[model samples]
Target: MFMVGRESEAFKHCTPIPILGVACYAFGLHLLKTCGIMRSIARADLDFSYITSRLAVMSQPAEGLVESAYRNHAEDVRALLEGRHKGHYTVYNLSGRRSGALSLHSGDATHMSGGNVVDCPGWKSHRAPPLSALYTLCEVMYDFLEADPKNICIAQCMDGKASSATLVCAFLMFVNMFPRPEDAAQMFAVKRTPPGLQPSEM
Candidate 1:
């Protein structure tokens, strides 16, 4: 719900445009620009059951299905369903022989570099089916929330800006489901450091 980065006059000018194509580009740039501050937010969590049910419905085996099973310590498909594990789950190495289950940053960063003219070492990357996989991950997180709404779910990246954006997106989804400002405010609070960025960031 909160974000922070170096303020730039260019971003101030560019943010108001309504075009999707331009907006996506600007958003990425904005994240890159705001690489210093560790932005964070608190929200009404998620409905874990709803998410798990959705994933259950979309049960299709993919490359990391076995790894997923292993990560959950799921002896059987039913066990995987019944388990309470959730929140920022990861599937380890799928790129090569040394591959195992790793969180977003734990896997091989080298494989992700796709012919970039400039090599940026220590920068993490991975290929995720953004449309399908992101939605599925959201659903799973929702299920985790439904299981226990009082429990807080926190996600962050190494840089923190991208994680902040993702947290906002997730919070917006929850607000759509329960449309009450007071309810949301009570459920979640944007926790940003330096306290100056809270108003504009959320």
Candidate 2:
């Protein structure tokens, strides 16, 4: 588990935190507050994106009751049940991966051993995903959340910084949890990673 961004042992794996109305489990792989962590990532890589205009939220129906569909995807469910997890499995990955990410019904992967990775390469550290990609990614996110409102989704990225946080913020705003993107960003900042703003700016 390569956690990053956050600086708490409670998040040794993932810690559940609410973003507006969505339940998010964030995992920061890098050591907290170390120079290596800071040197490795740019400040923009962990900052929230300010909204320029109202985002065109996606309004679509879920493909299916998809939550936990990947939990038992392996041929050996008994083996899966027997094993305990030190960290939350990367059930969903929001990168541009074509295979071995979603359940057998959703994509081509023999099993869920390799967590579900969405084909969303455009979404990176410094930029938001493209509109086309955003629609697909958020739709998948919404489907899983809607399949069971109790569902807890983990939003993670390569380093667990802005990319993951951005996903949660975008989803929260998509569901109208916040009126503006900035509101969602602010909520995340206060709860997860506080911006490196000076006292005057704060």
Candidate 3:
């Protein structure tokens, strides 16, 4: 799942930015950054070596778990984008490839170009902005999740549980059309704590 929106004349400012928690894989994070869906990323300073070690002990291979996690993460993202979200959070998926190499250009004359590379089939060009509709919802999600209104924090991820919680809070806000950010956070806190948690002990 990719985050996308209509082409804006001015890039959206990173005020209340979306926080992508570390629970997401590097590839997913990288895609958001490359697509310009993210304004700010939350990278908490903490020792995760122990958790990594523990993950290695699981019965299933670590690589498989990682891949499964990434797929689930993408599904969650798609749910947010396609679900009945209020405000500007609601977005439709766009598929198909562009005729030529996709490029991103800034008014300052800075530009970048890239496309799918194939070894035998030759290179392929995809349509520009494969994803759209994430710009506004991202802003609102940030506003709701931020702890301090002054120092706005957009997106965040912590442990698997907490990160899922954060995503659901934002999802609730967007889908239900909560009027106030506080309401969204509060509702999640009281009624939806650790929202959407999968049973791991089983």
Candidates 1 and 2 compared by TM-score, better number: 2
Model 2: ten consecutive residues of lowest lDDT: 52-61
Worst 10 residues of 1 by lDDT: 49-58
Tell me the tens digit of each residue's lDDT in model 2 across 94-197.
43333242233343112222223233445454455666655556566555544432233445444334565566666655554455655556655644563232
Each prediction's whole-model lDDT (CA): 0.27, 0.37, 0.25
Best by TM-score: 2
Candidate 3 structure quality by residue, lDDT tens digits, 83-129: 32222221111111121111111111011111111111111112111
Candidate 1 global Cα RMSD = 16.4
Better of 2 and 3 by TM-score: 2
Q: Measure candidate 3: CA RMSD.
A: 19.4
Considering every candidate listed, which one attains the maximal lDDT?
2
Better of 1 and 3 by TM-score: 1
Off by over 4 Å in 1: 1-129, 174-202
Ranking by lDDT: 2, 1, 3
Runs in model 3 with CA error above 4 Å? 1-158, 192-202
| Model 3 local distance difference test score | 0.25
